[model samples]
Target: MNRTNSSKSIRLLNYIEEKGNKLPHPVTIFILFTFIVIVLSHILYVMGTSVTFEGVNNETMETEMLTVEAVSLLVPEGIAYMFSNVVSNFTSFVALGPVLVAMLGVGVAEKSGYISALMTNTVTKAPKRFVTPIVVLMGVLSNVAASVGYVVLVPLGAIIFLGFNRHPLAGLSAAFAGVAGGYSANLVLGTNDPLLSGISTEAAKILDAGYVVNPTDNWFYMFASTFLIVILGTLITDKLIEPKLGKFVPTEPMGNQNNEVSAIEKKGLFWANISILLTILAIAILVVPENGPLRGEGGSIITSPFMSSIIFLMMVIFLIPGVVYGVVTKTVKNDKDIANLMTSSLETMAGFIVLIFFAAQFVALFNYTNLGTIIAVKGADLLQAIQLDGVLLLVALIIITTIINIFIAADSAKWAIMAPVFVPMFMQMGIAPEVTQVAYRIGDASTNIVSPLMPFFPLVVAFAQRYGKQNGVGTVISLMLPYSIMFLVCWTIFFVIWYLLGIPVGPGTNLNY
Candidate 1:
């Protein structure tokens, strides 16, 4: 009986995988869903219904438009207004701009062989056992470059792991865990931080008329999360993941790959390090003293001009050193090469450009329908009705988000859908949007390594296939199951502890309202 049940479960899983693989590309699916949402919203708007959440109270009696077209359509007035202003929604275009710029710089770093060379050299120098954790950490840090971590680091993890005497799939799992599972825990704010903040601000306005959630609201929490993720990720890889693949020898003879820094490379790296240090010193000198040019009148980092342009500073930090390395190593011949490198970076952002276009349209349509607002309001009412406490509420949210992540896959899209509802609800219940955002982030990130729908999941499969052709989605998922489960458990525990201690998650951010 047990064998029969196991066989049935395996067959069901196989059927699901087969169907999912045959489905439309995620970008296409987004476009189709956006169109459906827009059409339904417009139809509902034409009918007499109280689609606007703000005006929906018990005293409000929604008129039933008796006409067949109106009754069938169920359109609301505010939705029509929203549909009319589709072109005016700045959120659609503005959200994608930073990602484009960040990706451009990253493309240069990747296409010019800088990323590959750095990874190869690092792996060669490190001991075989340390490669997995280092790759995971690198994947976590690569969030600075936007989606480059998925494109570059995930595959490299498998390769670097194979270079050692370990299971390459385990290496891929570690990297994916860091890159996707810990995506929201970057030390520095990225394009996502602002986008989510904007959504939260809009949501919060429903409850607190003048409330504004800053883009950097969760920065401090995320900074601490970076360390938490690193330590947890390292422990999982070393203790659980590596041990499971017992005594598996590599199919191919290990190549004597030399990644050592030669005298010239060492000298170039030294100068690069010095240049970065000098750059930091210059910035410190400008900002540290009272009445310094970069400092605001308040002499606070939040109010300072230097802090405002931190991303550009990051670009300079990476670009200057990369250039110095290129010149010293003779990889970059002239200014023309530098221009080409930057331009090349922009070129590789084509996929992101396409994805963002659809994503923008979908978000705009969701807003136009007023469905997001109504859902948020209703959800808030239901949670209040239940009268759950803060900790339970957070746990419930994490569970809901994790389940949604399994099917939805896209972090930005899921957050865009969820933030409008939860942010305001939590704020009204005496919780900060930053706290809610952190919870959402943890849930969204923890499942990415195990979710087959993630865009990079197939790529990781291919990387694993290099060693064993039998490696597929199931294989990768099975390998990563431990990391995903451990991350979800340990990371949630850490968040609960942090909440209990009443530690500020970010700068000028609090756990409570």
Candidate 2:
């Protein structure tokens, strides 16, 4: 009977693997779904079945369209209107701008052997047993530089582990888990924090007259999440991923077996560290005081000069350290070399540029069709009707968000679509928009490791293939399955405990009954 049950389980697992591998590319699926949704929305609009919600007497109310023409299909109108107003949707375009610039700098750093040197030094110095967790933690933290971790650290993890006669895939899994799964849980705020917060703020205003969810609204929670994810990720990598990788047999032999840290690289690291500290100290002097140059008129963190010019701060942080490293390591012999590095980084963004073009169009078309808004309103209404408790509502939201994430992987875009609906609905139910945003972030972030729709998912698979040729999307997904499932479980538990304890999701945001 036991043998039979084991066989049944193996068959079931095989079935799942086959099905998952056969799934369509996420981007292609999204484009198809967008077209279908547009058609359905137009059909419903023409039938005069489309509803719009507005506030009346402190209660939410819906109004139906009277004229079929109001909802009618007007291809020419959509084309002309959407085409002419492309500039209006430029905010979506801006989302990809920083990613491109950051990548350009990172690409140069990678090409010049900065990342390779850094990894070699780090792994050699750290305790052998602790290397996997450390690499994972570093990958998670590297999200501040956008796609840098995905491109640089993940592959390095495999190479470094293989050099140590350990399972390379195990190291790759650990890095991928941190880079993708722990995306939103960074120690410092990244582009995503402000972007998601803006959407949440806009969504909150749909129900409340004056509502603003700060970008750092989930700062405290996410700060804690950084450590939690590291610990959980470390444990899983060591216990689950490493063991599953089986006995270590070198698949790809390393050309440079000498793992010794060179004096030049050591000097570069020290100089880079010093430059980073100096930069932080300079920023501190500017923004730490009430009357400092970087402080705003109101002396608030949000309104402060520091917050206003965070991108510049990021640029300085990366540029200064990178420059120092380049100089000390003799990688930047001339100004042309620095320019070439920046140029190289931008060159790597070609794929991303192509992706953003289609993704931007899809998002614009989606918003123009009013389908996103309609779904949000209707979905919110249905959830409202259930009268589920806060904990249950959160769980439901997480599950829904996770499902949606599988199809729509762009974090900002998904939140932009969801915020208008979920934020207001939760607010009406006495749940804070901040809490809702945090929940959305957690749900959105957790499944990224396993989802093919995620932009970096294919990239990781390609990286894995370098060490394991037979490894494809299926191999990558299967490996990350443990991390994804474990993250969702542990992350949800954290949320439940935080909610039950009535902890603040962010500075002024509370998780309450």
Model 1 per-residue lDDT tens digits across residues 66-94: 12111221246545654565455543454
The best candidate by TM-score is: 1
Scanning candidate 2 in windows of ten residues, the lowest lDDT window is 64-73
Per-residue CA lDDT of model 2 for 96-183, tens digit only, reads: 5555544544455565566556656776676887887788778777777667788777877887777677887888888888888999
- Residue pairs in steric clash, candidate 2? 104-345, 104-346
Q: Rate the local accuracy (lDDT) of all candidates.
A: 0.68, 0.71
Model 2 TM-score on a 0 to 1 scale: 0.79
Per-residue error for 460 in candidate 1, Å, reads 1.1
